[model samples]
Target: MSGTGEPLFVADGERDRIEVLHVEDDPAFATVARRFLERCDPSLEVTSETDPREALDRLEEESFDCVLCDYDMPGMNGIELLESLRESYPELPFILFTGKGSEEVASDAFSAGATDYFGKSSDASEYEVLAERIATVVEKYRTERQLERSEERYRRLVETAPVAIAVHRGDEIAFANRAAADFLGVDAPAELIGDDPLSYLDTDDRAVARERIARLLADEATMESLEERYVDADGNLKHGLVAGSAVEYGGERAVQVIVRDITEHRERQQELERYRQLVEAMGDGVYALDADGCFEMFNERMVELSGYSREELQGRYAGDVMTEAGLETVEAAIQSLLDGETDSVTVEVQAKRADGEVVPRELTLTLQPTEPGESFAGTVGVVHDITDRVKRERELEAQNERLEAFAEIVSHDLRNPLTVVEGHVELARELAEEGASGEELVPQLEAIADATDRMLSMTGDLLTLSRQGDTVGERHPVALAPLARDVWSTLDTGAATLETRDPGQVEADRTRLEQLLANLLENAVEHGSTDGQSSPDDPVETPADGADEGLTVTVVGTADGFAVTDDGPGVPQEDRDDVFERGYSTEQGTGVGLAIVRTVAEAHGWTVTVGESAAGGARFEFHTDG
Candidate 1:
């Protein structure tokens, strides 16, 4: 805008610092141009190149506000240089300060995108005019470059923002960022240009978005965030939280909208509702307590397990529900979690039930965080009743002690007398053979020897019965058919046959399990059938056609466990309950066989029951643990 020669000297304070690129064919003239340009305004820095083509290459490498060149030069001229630079940098200032004073050349300079034109002069006043023009052009170029840089930074920030951002003029979208385009299911931001934001919303929410936009433009309300549903390109409803505010854009009032996706938050709310329902229906007590051990939250199961109403437990301390001993345990467990010694702790305590009975219960506590450093904020607890488990353990201990006493009695008391009686029978049989009166006493001596042998046999059974198969430590999957055949080998059965049908695997201790199978086999052969035949070389005779037919024993696998069945006389229904009684014997053996089988089964947490087999014989069924 500096036009007249006198007004050109009007200074706009001190001029801004700028670098200029000057090109001339003469090295002496390039030096003169730098001197005068710096003298006009001390803030200007001028770089000169004698070769005009090299100057253009310098412009491409280095940053400069403006380019100064002569109109006439060898090979490429100033107009040709201006035309070449225009291809990439149209905003760069190119001024012609040449010796050629032709109006036609000046017209061509401006047409090639020259910023200003000046003719070379030896006059000192001409250099001053040219310097002022150079300063003005460079200052204008620097200001426009700074504006472009600032807009570039803002554009980058909007494009990469996590939330959707769009600038709207009236109802149409003027600009949109990458996130905004993606939210609308478009490939590029330009596709949203001239599109209405309301069109992306469902029909139900479009009016709400319109009303909010109207209120923002009218200045009737301050900026507010709201949850709404927007429709994507596929017409699927998408949940979002959006905020809109009036902003000055493009020299007009426009709305700048920011939207955040909230579909995950909605899904989380639904999940929490389902968890609440599930916890309320649980059987074990579930509760949450604060760091001070006061109840913060609880489920319906907690009220039932603690024997307290919801009203009573709402603000009550958890220690009040537990006894002094229980409180001691509770305090230690909570301290362990708070000190970071462990993440969770479990302990057993006595809890008072609603019926005034103190039930044995186990409580488990887990650490939780309310804030970053305050991870000891609260503890989640689960209480489970263990009364039955405790009672069964005590009964098992008492049963073991009784078995130990029985073994001692059989070893010391019964064995000594039976051994002495067998010794006397042997001496009497030897005396009867040596003397004449001994012939009559030989049968009596032999009868006495047979009675002692029977007594010894009964004594051996007593000791074996005293060895109650109590504990079975680690159980393995034992194949029933092989184990049954092994057990049958140990038993003295003659005509009795062992049959296995689908004898699948059962988890049991092998040695103790063998004993169980041996007892079951003995019971089947001895007491199962009175008419069952023994081996042809045996002394025991069979009563023909009694309750036994084939006298077959079967080991069959059941769903939960296995069964040992027989085709002999079945136990009467009235006597089934007393079959496992300790001293109840029917025929030749100590009655403790079935009782020992029951003991071993109990140790493994199995249930033993006697029922009639399919062929009218006794079936011993064992059910495995739950």
Candidate 2:
């Protein structure tokens, strides 16, 4: 491109067409010159104008690569035209070809900035010579412009780069970017120019720097970065990573180096390594899960708890090792934290092991801490195995249940028998004071004795439950049928009948099992009566008066254990769930009978459930496999 008002100049070799403008005073001569130039070079496209002033007007309106003009004729001479064109189109190629040949005219044409000066003659070869001159001047003009544009682009790239960039010409700094100046604590890159680059590096690293520069300039394919220390403008030491390669700068071999300050980065890495060691040494299982709920980090304790190796668990989804219910619980907790509803969550879940075993575990989860202005990345959790703790809690609960039953008996059951005894004693006193017959007094005494015996029996049972605390002493094989018959004989069942069917042996604590059986039989005998009487303790619907009769209790063997069924009004469907609770009675007796039965069954590691019997009575089923 011409610097004087032209858009851009297409290089001669690269251009598909070259346009030329010819100015002459004679119209015929201008026409002939245009034809001759075009014929000499098919790539040349020429336009002829007779008036020099008109030629300048055409040049202003159109684009051309080169201009040809005559030395003399008409209003302006070639020297005058060349001088006038130079004012506006300084870089445009111009050749002065004239029929008037003189040493003075040629010297004036060149002085006026003509790219070439030639004398026109009668020889036909003159046109060819002029054509070559036009091509040479235009190509040189375009080549110079291309090189200038390229240099400008490279300069901009170096100045704006983030890392420190410097070009070393021999042993002196030929160039330095803004970043290099800032890194060296200088006000501007000009301050670093012409200084030895080695002067910036520490004395200890100067030798290595020199060797590296030599290797780079030799083009030995050195791509490795060097860690070197430098002295800033303030005379303080600093660290950087430097990389360099051989390059050409201003037609001279040079080494272009890029420097990155990494002092802070190295310190941060050291701090992180310390934290990693602390985490690995923790006792409890610690784990970190990424946003996708996959394991990103864990300690040795975590591997042991999960029974999975580090390689197996890394990047694996958490759901793969957790039970479905547990995974859902954890997911919900994570959502609650993300919503800012909670800072942390602790939950007990079943962890499925690689060996197909389920282990009870407690986990405390919290969002991983992040730097300010950073988003939530993942979760951190600490795991604890709570199997032993859970077992102890169950035992404590069982003991509490027993204590509750004992309190009820002492408060209500024992008081009732004591009140009965007091009433009978008062009646006997009145009978004696009125001089009643001895026979009448004897019946009152017997009633007092019966009440006293009942109180004593309840006291003994309470003492046993309180002292034992639901703990079974020892286990032995016992026959169910004989045990039931023996317990029935001891109970004052009134008119109730007992039936045994398919008796079997069960491993149990004999003393505890017998007490369990006795309580069940007593519960049935006391409540299974359809006597049309609703005791204060039993709040069920009373049967019809004529329906008064004793009920039959049956002991039946089951595949896993046994059951006690009674043929009487069955327990209310709504009340079955609470039947074994302390103080929940459906009969005329202490409400603790079934509660003791449950305590004993649990102590023996058995499960008990109450349901309706086929004969419209309550059925108590005991499973030994609990």
Name the best candidate (by TM-score). Answer: 2
lDDT of 2 at 224: 78
**Candidate 2 global CA lDDT score:** 0.81
The reply for model 1, stretches above 4 Å from the true place, is: 1-397, 400-469, 529-550
Instruction: Please provide, for model 1 over 131-154, each residue's C-alpha lDDT reduced to its tens digit, 9 standing for 90 to 100.
Output: 788878866776776677778887
Clashes of each: 0, 1
Candidate 1 clashes: the total is: 0
Candidate 2 lDDT tens digits, 112-206: 89888888877878889888888888778777877877788876768797789999964899999999998999999999999999988877646
Give all TM-scores, in the order shown. Answer: 0.36, 0.50
Q: Which ten residues in a row have the lowest lDDT in candidate 1?
A: 1-10
The residue pairs in collision within model 1 are none
lDDT scores of the candidates, listed in order: 0.76, 0.81
Clashing pairs in 2: 1-9
